[model samples]
Target: MMMMNKPNWRLLATAAVVSAALTACGGDDGNDGNSGEDGRPGGEPATSVSTLNLKVTDASFSNGLPVFTLLATNEDDEAVVGLQGLKVNVAQLLPAGHQVVGDPTKWQFAGDDSRNGAAEIVDQKNGYYTVTFTSLDKAQLDPNFTRRLNIVSPAGTLIDGTTEVPNGQASFDYNAAGAAADYTRNIVATDSCAACHGEGNGIHHGSYVEPETCATCHDGLKAEGGRTNRSFAVLVHDVHKVAAAEDADGHIQYPTELSSCNVCHETSAPAEELAITEWGNWSAVPSKENCASCHADNNHIMEQADSSRCASCHTAEGTGVVKGTIDAHLGEWNDAAEVISQWGSDVEMAYFADTDTTTVTVSITDANGQKLAADQVLPQIKRIEVLTNLGPNYPVLSYGAGSHLDAVSNGELANNTTIVDGSFVLPITGLPYGAEGTDADTAFSFVGLAACSKGNAIVACADVADPDNTDNYTGMKANMAFVTKSGFTPSKRHTDSLEFSKCEGCHNDNWQIHKGYHSGFVMTEQVAHDEEGKVIGLDGCVTCHTPDGTYAFNNNGAWEQKLHVVHGDKNIINDCTQCHTSFNLNAFAKKGPINTGAGANPYADGLYGTPITATCASCHSYPSAIDHMTGGTFGNGVYDVDKADAQLAVSAENCFVCHAPDVADHSNVKF
Candidate 1:
């Protein structure tokens, strides 16, 4: 949600603390005198206060008398004293999925937020303050019920954390019984959502980024639109299933397939970062709130959404056909691991300039480093493929095309692939773009994979008993590819752009794409390598997805612009640091006009828009924004993108007047 107007207390923070300076020679002073040398105009001193940070030292509802002690600090980590108008909201956290009747035991509001707040304040003059709040009876306090204290700081640079500003709100969980409970509610971590939500402009109320923090009010007793619309699963499912804004609300579709649970949940494998303590709760703990989040209109599911009877039908002991939650989510993760021994592969490549051929060798071995038995494993090999393209910065290579070597798709040649010493050696002849002799270009060969589904017995991929389990996986993580050149020097262009590992922090394990394609999500290709030959994350993707390889099917923008558009549509790219390791290097600023598309090259209109304009168009595609980008007043003198020669239709965008050649600085780049 966007930030609303500032509170009365926030206005006081900005109020000038007047102090007279009589030693100034400037405009006429308020003494009704002429503009003379002695006309002293008061110079105001700049306030040193930045944003505020509060840490809860101790909190408890001991014996029904709620008291909270906290320490406040400014952005410089200096103690901030004499702070006032700091309010708090309290709530009770019930057990996960615990519901009475048709309503969830959500945390309703109490204290200053809901009632006439009467908090007895005590300042220790050392940034520490003790506030005794309205007392709650022992009947209101349950030892297992986790109480939440949300500190709302109104005396800071920004009370509502808008844009890049830090919102002065702090929350901490504590048991009213004055001790840590055995059953603490820890679902999604802050880092999990912070990568996409908090790191940008902060989600919802700006500061309440964590699910646990948001659950203080959003999930339970009272919500904006009741339980149906307020749960995390519901809001997340809806927003991801259909785009929220920057496009037609609910009309826009998700960038990738929504069926892939691995996009958000880390059930397939162990989470390396952003751990979810109750990762298994999604399937194990069935609730009406969970079921109805996605199956909104399903009356059968909606009826069961708010009750404790959800598991009665979905669990193993239930009479229903549906298996338990653990099986529903982790079933595939379990299926594949049973049969596949997580084998590894080694590859070698060499381009013989004399014969105009590129030979690639692939050796697959089990976890024990033993070669697979031909009769036992050859039948299970679903596909063996390799892809190649020109590198450094290929002006032609795109995701749509690849110089491929697939034994299954492309008919096997009699002398093409031969098993030599337990390794399959295949030589591909002919120069697609590379010139023969000393003028040869580099060949970047990347391996592709199509894993077979788990089976009781080793069998052909086509004859698998469970085809449903195969769709659970994606990517070409078989083995790293080899790069060879016939005197062709490689370019560092591939490794110079956005780091892929940064994206993996959110996308987890491997970023999946292309849906059910055999090589759905190819792992990082060795198209670009460091001096030590160590492969960075998905460096090969740049060889494709280039300026010319515009994935924008709507002719909206180039690949550079699309990345922003895709992430922006999700309302998460407000801050470049969300994905970029360094925005100060002008990484977000690409040169030249975007090749939106070309004539009959996937798109019919061959559109070309200005670079900076395309980046801005992602959020501001209105008529006024169009006028700003095209330098047209009321649509006059506008560059016609739909001209007879659309490729030559260049825009008269004046963004460069400020953007210039160097955008290495992060100063207000949003414009």
Candidate 2:
């Protein structure tokens, strides 16, 4: 996972020579140079840089000033000649108690036009350069200070004639006592930020590549605009606040709550304790404004109030109770139900294919393992439903006719009884038979809403309007049973890659994005049996997204690409590994180079019509893809001039004909 610094020059050069020798010879048809129908000459060798390596050869202190020498070379083991306008930045890492006071300066070299300032760069011929720090202030130096170096080339460098090499960085630690200083503790991983910021670059105008480097400049000081920028802790928190800023449509641009703390602050420590410590240090003292960020409804605290009021509910000793801020923010449903007598239900379903009918039987019981009487159950239960999964094509079928069904009015029951001795049997009509072959079996699940009734009415139920309440009486009974077909066995579809807990990590208890059912009750039959039969839970979604399922809309329903397109619409698709694991991305590549029409078209929207190799380079390095494409035949031979549009279209078999092995390494197809 480290950056690309070392490249094998010998191998690259040898491969280039071999490829040129092979191309110099004629083809099987004895055609040396011929123009195709598209007005492009065939067998034109691809010109690319074999290697571009930037390295720090040596570093030392000269008369209390730090000096370093850098070297740049190409694949032929020769100096990179005539490189100009190279910019280099040097920053000293400060200790925990210290802070930066002013903007640091960068050293630039333009050959003979270079100017000597606080830092000077001198060309030493043959790709070597000596840089020296001129003005050294002992007050800015410490026994434990470390230096970080970053070098970047101007707009274009002659690597493969026109390709530009990416920047590189190196770190140097200096100790006055001639010993190594203990490395500072990192609060957050760069990969987490790269998940949305595209490899840690292209964020904040590419000025900073890593968080440590960012801390050097944005260290709680006023910038050129006369506005003070807070420390990293405060800046990051305030920037991502749910109501911090709004877009033209009056919607919050970065709508994330503090409840999703684990998504970023995912240390080994308990998230609850980590959040308290992080926020406590950031604010120093709690304020009503801080509390109002997430708890806008709780208006008990005054603006001038200190941490004492917050500690009353957020600390164990202050309130004479064990509850704290964690318990208060997580909501009541996080813990077990308090009532001693709890209610539950068990359901069984039998289907009759000839009559297109399904018979459902339900039994009710209490926490003490005793069946309640029919009259007692009828008054406590709110509703009961039977949901059926009818294979891949058809949607799930729900048997609940209306909002609330009365025992006496709804007469689809056996013997016209809704509940008899805590049990009831109802026959529902118009259920379709299961599909043939692998999908011949059907799954039926039951849902019952049991409430703590007040005055013969179910009150304090769990609804979308008020989701934090624990008084909601909801229970699910999922049972897999074959329809009235002989020798039929039901099985689940492919294993899901995305976990429900992962979604809950950001969406919290309420699946707020969809703005309907909460994640807490997504698996229940009530939410799973929607009007469109859109399976509510992540587990149920795979049934409808199976190989045989209908997916004419949205990238032909290729789950991975469709997910990318959806997130791209929301401007969240930056790094591929954000949603997919490294193993998953490798597996996708193993399915062979994409865009050959083997699977559903994965390119859409932001990536629509993008080249196959260029798209592959989004997650992979350009050099690695060059090796894969040149190792063997790739892509279809037919290159559609209109289909390619702006992307490179070439058969893997003839990739080397256009892109020579050496120049391929420095191609501009990658991000």
- Runs of candidate 2 with Cα error greater than 4 angstroms are 1-132, 135-185, 194-209, 223-231, 243-257, 270-389, 393-429, 438-516, 519-539, 542-566, 575-577, 580-671
* Top lDDT prediction, candidate number: 1
Whole-model alpha-carbon lDDT for candidate 1? 0.49
lDDT tens digits, residue span 190-229, model 1: 5555545534244765445445556555553333322223
| lDDT string, candidate 2, 1-671, tens digits | 11111122332332243233323321121213234312112332223334554545455555645566665555443455445556555444454333222112111111111232266777655566677766532224444565444455443555345655444322223344322323322344444455344443545544354444444334443442111345454556565663324455443334233444433443223333331223222122233444554445665654434444453344522244644544454333232122212554455567666776666666665665566665555543434444344542222322121111222211123234456455776665654555454343454432333343332234343222332232333322222222433335543332233333334433333322211121112233323323333334543442333222223322323232334444554555554434433122222221112222222422332122123443333334346454564344542222112234323433233432454321123232322
How close to the true structure is residue 632 of candidate 1, measured as C-alpha lDDT?
45
- Note the Cα lDDT for every prediction shown: 0.49, 0.38
Candidate 1 clashing pairs? 106-220, 106-221, 283-325, 288-305, 475-521, 476-521, 476-522
Against the correct fold, how does model 1 do in TM-score?
A: 0.69
RMSD of 1: 11.8
